[model samples]
Target: MTSAPDMTGRTLLQVIPKLKGGGAERTTLEVGAAFVRAGGTSLVVSSGGGMVEELEQGGSEHIAMPVESKNPLLLAQNARDLADLVKERGVNIIHARSRAPAWSAFFAARRTGTPFVTTYHGTYGAKTAIKRRYNSVMVRGDAVIANSAFTAQHVRKQYEGLPYFDGSRMVTIPRGADLERFDPASVGEERIRPFSLRFGEGFKVVMPGRFTGWKGQGVLIEAARLFREERPDVPLRVLMAGRMDEKPDYVDGLRRRIAEAGLQGVVELMPATDDVPALLAASDVVVSASTDPEAFGRVAIEASAMGKPVIATAHGGSLETVLDGETGYLVPPGDAEALAKALGKLHALGAEGRRAMGERGTQHAGQKFTIEAMTTSTLLVYERLLGQKG
Candidate 1:
């Protein structure tokens, strides 16, 4: 097979904490693959994870490093190593996806006289001066790319006195969902049957978030309990599909709660999988029950793009994505009663009403949330940066 085009003439290095499965990681992979597709070189430096294989398959180079460490000594080492890579590879630019790596990439790009770009994916709760300082690298890039309009506002509000953000170096290129992977047409009815099988032909209500308490999996379980109590004949099932990441005890607790509430037969817990499009397609109503503000509810966007109605908590990007009572419903965060009420209304929506809502969701997704739109807007920002560099 032909290798990814040599990027020697136009090399870019992407620095992140690790090649993990998050929005920033996914975006990094996408940009790297896109760069390779466009006959440019893309190199990623990180403490490698599952995405390493995908990066190599996509014809990009991977350099394993302890880039995620917060210790000052490790960061200094990263800076030196990154600068060496930048100089040796003739990297034209350095894009950092997290703060720790941004700290190293920033200085490396500077030492090599290469452009430095950063994406402010979300806000991290700062508890101390050092914490704030650690977060500053995210804004210090030559061009700071904010992933959402809300994040752009936060960046400005936080760095009010910073000069670059005076509308010149700051640009908002919203994150996007992979429509090709998430499209309803891509998943057939037969493939969707297993998800329904778990619920025994019930109206499948699914909450697709990591199995953490903050993700409100417990609240969703409670909501399912309420739904079953009220409508025993509706044949309802709640599927919690996500990796019990960083919190196995919480997952166990959810199981205990499920049993305590006598929902063992009504609720199913599934691990994270790549079959999100199929899950969304099979779902009667998709839920995003993050008790906290999600930087952005990608699941909501993907579900909407697939013409599925979503019920997300009314916080963070969900407010911007879900049109309350129009495309989908939004309830108060962490309120299972309100969640149950919203799901009740969604279930009450017959085939025609649900179809109409799904249509509206798809229209919104097509207009605002596709990968092409996101990529095109980002390219505009890059062109502006390159032009200014020239």
Candidate 2:
């Protein structure tokens, strides 16, 4: 493992649209905490949300700004404000985690002669030249960080012909799960009791992510119907747990589908919860049935860290995170029948076999995706960019 560098007396600034519950927001907090741990001054700029208090608790300072606005004048003004902040705070490096804020941060860094870094957290849509140009700011960093190898490949392919684009600058740093929190041993019956009451007696299958069509909640519902038909004697329950406010129509559609399939009692849609580790611990099997590719599958890693078998779509980052038939199973993306088959295989494993799979998954997660490894790698990138040593 690489040692973290001496970041004492240096200041690092991270910019994101908001302090939300997305992967990028979580990474921002993790990196900020890492910076403070190394004795460096850590600062974050965002529109502000639920995570502000948590970020501050990690010994990082937060500046509230309207970085989420896409208005051209607002963005340009933000750039000027950021440049002032950079100079005033003696910020050594500026890191951007979202597209809108990246544009502003890129200009600010150039204006202040500070090293700039960016983490491409998504496979951004580039349907037109204008869209591609807008997305280009994410790759303009001195060191471009990608959440996964799959994301790095997407970046290279998307900007293949740009004369100034250097693919070699892109680095893959897989997102990590908090092993201390997600450990099965840490989540006891007391924590799992509430969910167990709701789940009742049966094998619990959990699909957790924000409610969206691409998340494949409908696909999972169809698969649940199939699973019930094939094994009438076996008891099973499916929970679609996530926030539904973003797409109320989609949530309504899912409810209709669940009712049409006669899975009203068997399948339930629940709101997102803060206690994800406990939920996964209570689950018999966790699923990530996305119709589209994920930049990196954090849910899969989190579930694996909790020592639970995950059934994820066989595309995107899941291909990199999950070891098929070992830690968990990977079914064809969007294939309801294939998902049903995979669920059946896990059900047949029974308690002992499933427990063994979970153990392997836990070990794999510790070796490859712990938060310590991720923070160390990311700090190394900052150290290299600034020509600093431990």
Candidate 3:
């Protein structure tokens, strides 16, 4: 990252609904620490979660509040509270990472005359006018940062005719993989050994994400079943790891499918893990089978960075990150047959061929999707807005 911009007395207060294990939450902490390292006071406003301690340890203060509430009354109340906090703590800029919190942060910035910034983290579905208006808060920021080029384009298309919408204010900044943790050189056998034993020497493939309907964990299970049918001679093991508690019914559905398809031992639904990079390192290949488009699929790039061949759905951010026939293969969204076919193709490549593809993917992620690059780009946006305010 270029020279840390001089942010000596400035303060960056990032507001989000929760301090949790998601892309937005992770980015919130990463950017806060970068702000601190650049000689600024960094504060986060959220309902505390497991990551709060980590945030504090990195020199960012965490303020517990009800910013996650979507109730109209609570939004106004949160805005008042945030405005007061901004004045009390001398918060230079308020960056919101979610819709509900963005509403509060927007008014707080207005009330306190502090620069308001936002990151568009999801492709919010807006089937009605009310929903569209509700989603509009993100674009209202003095600067709106989209996590991927696909997201930037979507935002521009969706919000172009809005009265105050200025496309220039939006920028594309991809979510980054934490290289320090994901570095292959740093991950020793001790870390990989446990997972290695559990999944065994079979061609281990892992899909790590929240076990939601749209995440397509079921699709992956189906693909695994089909792959076993097609390549019965080959040993196939699939690990679908995520927070199954959030969607018990869906998880049950996946479990039933795995059992009925006779993929009980071949496919396993493990709990969410903190050490995803190690899981990627332990596996022969990684998979991103999201039926819906990912705003920015961090897992695909993270797997690539770990020298594992990735097979991701050929849509959204995956298109930009995964180079078909090079870094990884991209299959049609929700097409189990195509996904299974891609897996077979990877197996055909043999060990050395897969390694070469993974090497290219590592280079691709190292050059483009990196933690330092993401943090540095974000700091630039903050400093630019601060410069404007002066």
Go through the candidates in order and give the clash count of each. 1, 0, 0
Winner on lDDT (1 vs 3)? 3
Best by lDDT: 2
Q: TM-scores of the models, in the given order? A: 0.93, 0.98, 0.98
- RMSD to the true structure for each prediction, in A, is 3.4, 1.3, 0.9
* lDDT, candidate 2, at 307: 85
Instruction: Please estimate how well model 3 matches the true structure, expressed as its whole-model Cα lDDT.
Output: 0.91
Q: Which digits, one per residue and each the tens of the lDDT, describe model 2 over residues 1-390?
A: 777888999999999999978899999999999999998999999999999999999999999999999999999999999999999999999999999999999999999989999998889999998999999999989899999999999999998779868887789999999999898888889999999888889989998999998999999999999999999888889988999898999999999999999999899999999999988888999999999999998999999998899999999999988999999999999999999999999999998999999999999999999888998999999999898422
Clashes of 2: 0
lDDT of each: 0.81, 0.93, 0.91
* Cα lDDT of model 3 by residue, 1-390, tens digit: 476687789999999999877889899989988889989999999988999999998899999999999999999999999999999999998999999989989999998999999999989888899999999999999999999998998898888988979898998989999878888999999988888987976788899999898888888888998999988888899988888789899899998999999998899989988788788888888999989999999999889989999999989999999999999999999999999999999988888998999999999999999988898899999889999989
lDDT of 1 at 267: 88
For candidate 1, lDDT tens digit of each residue in 57-157?
A: 87789999999998889888899999988878878778898998889888888887788889987767767867777788888778888887777777777
How many clashes show up in model 3? 0
